[model samples]
Target: MSNVVNFLTAGVFGGTTLLALKSGVGCGLSGLRRRETLFLAFVYALTALIIGAIAGSIPVNATEQVVGLGVVMHLIIGLALVYFGIRTKKAWLSDRKDISRRTFLLMSLPCPACLAATFLSCLVFTSTTGVSGVAAGGVIGGVFFAGIAGGGAATSWITRKAGMDNPSTLGNVMLFLGLFYLLCLLLVPAYLQAQDAPAFGIATDPSGMLLALVLMTALIVFGALADRIRHTAERGGR
Candidate 1:
């Protein structure tokens, strides 16, 4: 059912982000290459399916339950990345002179914003009345975060490999882009619901999805730009 779809979407987005971050992808607008992008997307979607199913089966209500759970999941993942990045800073320092303790705080900034938005949406919605509602909400929330995580990972991987002093900036910025999309989800639905809306109408709203797409496109573009910048800097140094 819809729950199944939501689960799948969540798994894809979340899984892809983690995988890409762990393994450096590539940079350049052309770097993702059509083949690599498709492959990574497929991998993310499949992983999302497995994880989403397991996460969905925890005897939770569709309302505040799923939303709350999703927030916790996102927060945990975001924090973990910050931690890993912090731990790796020293190791990367010899290569990146500008890497500093403050970078840790910068990396951690997106979590709270995302966490708050997720929690607020659940509370504001205040109703998980049926399977349909649950599925709809889940997809919106799941895809939004997945986009954040996945996109962040993709951008980060590209930047890091491009040898930018602050390659993670790409990922971190993309993560915030995801967070903003989440905020849109929170506010848009509430606005519609308050105005006495139909579930179907809200379901079709493209803002969240569109935002994600735009972000993904931008990340690719920026990745390409970052590569050029790195190349130029290296030449200038010589």
Candidate 2:
């Protein structure tokens, strides 16, 4: 039950899941066909699975090294998110064109948060359940990714139903969400480290997790508010 909870939580809040939501909104706004949207979602899931399998193969003895590498990777992802946000904002202000499907698909592939979540889910499950081996890891990975896909599909459906299919609106939302996601990637690890929590896998410190979640939510709100203010100022200037 704990493992199930962890898997579900990770999938819901993972960066990849967020990316999927963005993808869905972008697809709806861009007038992408249903087949194309599904194809992109499938690509995300497949990439996550591959990342999970590779991360799981790391030996337990190398756990410290993995954590260090994860921190570095998270930093890199954070920067990528910032760059993406800036680009999206620029595109919105200039051409107002929708992002390309190819670019979206590629971005989904390297989602560090999703990769970390899936890897940690597998690690925690195996550690707790006495399930050791590549096969067990693969099963856990599948389960984690299944949750991600479900969340992605649900968000996409909701956005489509809500008629949020405008390119400029979608672009603005993506830019803000990207910044929020970047904040999460950069801060969560540092928070855990400060708490002296477990080096890898899920931190046992509930307070730390709660704090991270709260901070992430706050970041999202901040991003949204900032975007609103910027738009208001622009309109006033005009």
Candidate 3:
């Protein structure tokens, strides 16, 4: 049960964040003219998460070494990701070739985060269980994020290919809701397993989970209401 919880939480936190961040780019590029900031927040949240996970993984003999190394590594990795993301976007625009599903998947690979998450999670998990358990945990975290990033890239490509005429705000709203729901599902189990740990802390048990569900539900509802209001206003021309 504990293992199941851990894996699920890792997946939720890892995967949803990836999707949110990718989608957030669309929102920002859209000039926030009407884009959902929820999606953008999701992106920011996801990036911070992977950063935390990877930084947590650094093996250090001293406290200062740990802090210094984690900071430097994160900076380097963040820059590389931004560079590649830009390049990928450019490639899509320049070639005018539809981003092949395969290409998107290939591009979605989270270079440093995947490796860093695995390494860091492995170290943390290993102390709890054994080397084998840590290895498995690392694999799970890496695969989850990789799949997420890939899926987001694919979705973005498909959305671009589909091309909307008016560009509905609902698209971004749905993107945020979908990612949030998935993340919530993933974390529920993890929160359950970790509930008993003194230092570890489950982070969220039944009440917390319920609260999250309610909050996410509210977000979805609010987003939908906003969309309706916008559409009505546009039709009214004032």
Candidate 4:
């Protein structure tokens, strides 16, 4: 029961939770149909579960292989985020209509953050719960899906209330989140290496935690200031 609770908590507020929230906000800001938004959310959650189940099924002896793969996947994702951030900024500034809700939703489907989180969660669930195979996968996936869907819904609501439907605002949010995810991709692996800890372990490096907190705080502050400046300029122009 405690294990279940922990898995659910991680799903809601874990590092990957940010990805889910970002997807939700993107969906809302893109003016996607209500049904489309819900469909995307469901698909994302289901994908995470399926991936988690597959990861959990891997033999314990192959831990190193899994970690290596995860690292590679994250590296690719980090680079992709950097590219996407630059492109999004350009598009936003140019008032380009190149980006679409379908594209954004598709991209969010295989989020590296979600994949990593699911992988780790599956390992934890298998090890701690002594539940393996399809049944364990189903449980882990269901809980994770619930947590992500719930978080996404909550974030979508908040973003709507904050007038994040504006293209500029949405672009900034996406750029900010992209950078944040990139930072996580870089820092998390280094932290794990430094601690000589298993990727799925609960052990945390204090320095890594502090650095992440500091960086995230700075990103939030910078985003807020940028938004204020943009809004002010718009008002002045009007």
Best by TM-score: 4
lDDT of 1 at 186: 50
Number of the top lDDT candidate: 4
Superposed model 3: Cα runs more than 4 Å off: 1-118, 121-174, 177-182, 185-199, 203-205
The pairs that clash in candidate 1 are 11-48, 12-44, 12-48, 26-158, 28-224, 29-224
Residue 45, model 4: Cα distance from true site in angstroms? 3.9
Q: Write the per-residue lDDT of candidate 2 for residues 1-238, one digit (tens) a residue.
A: 8777667545534633444555555555445566765665666555545655565578877666655666677656555644564555556565675564433432345355445555665565555555554544456444434443454466466666887544444445545555565566646766767777764344446676578668867875786688679889988999
Per-model tally of clashing residue pairs: 6, 0, 3, 0
Off by over 4 Å in 4: 1-19, 52-56, 96-103, 193-238
Question: What TM-score does prediction 1 earn?
Answer: 0.30
| Tens-place lDDT digits, model 1, residues 125-227 | 2223233334433543454444534554565565658775353443444345345444545566657766887742554446865776588568647855776
What is the TM-score ranking, best to worst? 4, 2, 3, 1
Of models 2 and 3, which has the larger TM-score?
2
TM-score of each: 0.30, 0.58, 0.36, 0.64
